[model samples]
Target: MATKLGKQTYQPDNPPFIISTGTVAGPFEGQGPLKDYFDHVYTDTLAGERSFENAEKEMMANACFTCLQKVNVTPQEVDFYLAGDLLNQIISAGFCALELNIPFLGIYGACSTSAEGLALAAMLVDGGFAKLVLASTSSHNSSAERQYRYPTEYGVHRKPTAQWTVTGAGAALVAGYGAGPRITTFTVGKVVDQGIKDPMNLGAAMAPAAAATMVQHFADTGRGPEYYDLIVTGDLGKFGRELAVITCASKGGFDLSKNYNDCGLMIYDTEKQDVHAGASGCASSALVVYGYLYRKMLAGELKKILLVATGALHSVTSFQQGASIPAIAHAVSIEME
Candidate 1:
């Protein structure tokens, strides 16, 4: 059963465990700091596929397959599979689900899809409705760029605040009983719009939402910054991470100086990669959490951590209509015992 801690948070009595994970990275990400941590890395963005969209589907499918193979669980034995991506109608996830042939639930939270899927999977397992659930998400730089912004063929000049969409996918298998990090709590965030209308400045649009969710998680669980070994945000990049720290202190009076970091900053070398702000996409936090952080927890490096995955909820149509970006963040607390 799941206990309602407050309006925005829930605590599961029989916490679900993340038994296994698989992360697949593209060439650019393979060249980053955590290159050696990823389960699989492709040499190119196309990945030997006909199009970038097909390549994304391939990556997502490979991630799920790797996750299942690691635990020796077949697709037929899985209870449910939840996934999402940045493509139109979540085509990447839809196609991958079709291939898996498992009971599927497609979700969309932009880049927050990773945490959102995990949260829902935890609830289903804790409620005894499911024995095993797989949560996953994917994003491609070329696919996202052509849909959300300018096409890569145009060679458009990117702004200093712009972030690079990660070209990768990540998947994790969650079960009711397992020898791995347990998902203890989850915090759902509200849609927050700070009136920032720049499509290029995703960090500025999402910072307030990340702060709101993080502060609420602390309040609901009756814990402070010292409770967790690490506090990480999804894809806030460098600018939004700084803004999130300042916003948390000013609004909630909670200082996040000691143990806070952003997945975007950890995924790439901002100086050498020419990534202006940092990485942003469904895979930004997904790869780091499923690949690096999860392994670190297993190795006894980190006991507890809070993952806050943030997303900007604006479509190309909305941006073209002069609408401001509305962002949201979802938090999940994972602990190893």
Candidate 2:
């Protein structure tokens, strides 16, 4: 039986292992600092497709196929496919599902979709409902921009706190029998709003939510920041990163200065890339988790890791209505046994 810890945490007695992962990045991401970590990098952001949406679909499908190939599993063998993205109605995930022809469950957690998918898949497998499940997500700089903000063709000047949406796709295979990093537990977050309304400043919009979830995770697990080898945030850019540290310190007495890091800050070189603050979107945390962290865990470098994927749940309609951005973050605890 799964144990519910505190308010929002779940600890499964038999945890599901992340057997394999596949990641693909766009041209911009290919040029980023973590370029070497990606498995595939598209020279053309459109990826030979007619539209950016099509390109995103192709990237996600390719990532799913690549994940399956790593473990030599076919789509037919996967019991369920769990995925989501930033597009409206999750079109990217839907198109990818159409190609894979697997049992699909489309989810939406804004930028936190990756972790939400993984958490749900882990629960499905741990609950003995499925033997294998695939969790995947994607986000294109072009696609997300048009959906949430002005199209890139507008060439709108970005604010200093703006975070670049990641142009990439990342997928992972989760199963019960595997010798890999196991997802031991998870904590789901609620929508949190701190009255931040600027769409460009996603980091600030999401920092409070990240801090809330991190504090809840510690409280639920009865562990301090030192319990994990590293505590990673999904994409709380630069300003958000600093704010999260401050919020955690004041809110929970947790000074995460020693072991905390942000995927947004780690993924790109802000100084050269001119990405204002850093990176965001679904792939922000996905690429880092699937490409960099997974390999490091296999090499025995990281024994225990906490991945907290944050999201800004804002839409053009909501932003236009003068509503504050509501954010959420989901945390997955990974451990190598």
For 172-262, candidate 2 gives per-residue lDDT tens digits of 9999897899999999999999999998898999999999999999999999999999999999999999999999999999889999999
Question: In candidate 2, which residue pairs clash?
Answer: none
Show the colliding residue pairs in model 1. Answer: none
- Candidate closest to the true structure, highest TM-score: 1
The TM-score, computed over Cα atoms with residue i paired to residue i, of candidate 2 is 0.99
Instruction: State in Å the error of residue 119, model 1.
Output: 0.3
Full-model lDDT, candidate 2: 0.94
lDDT of 1 by residue, 1-337 (tens): 9999978999999999999999999999999999999999999899999999999999999999999999999999999999999998999999999999999999999999999999999999999999999999999999999998887899778889999999999999999997999999999999999999998999999999999998899989999988999999999988999999999999889889999999999999988999999999999999999999999999999999999999999998998899999999999999999
Worst 10 residues of 1 by lDDT: 149-158
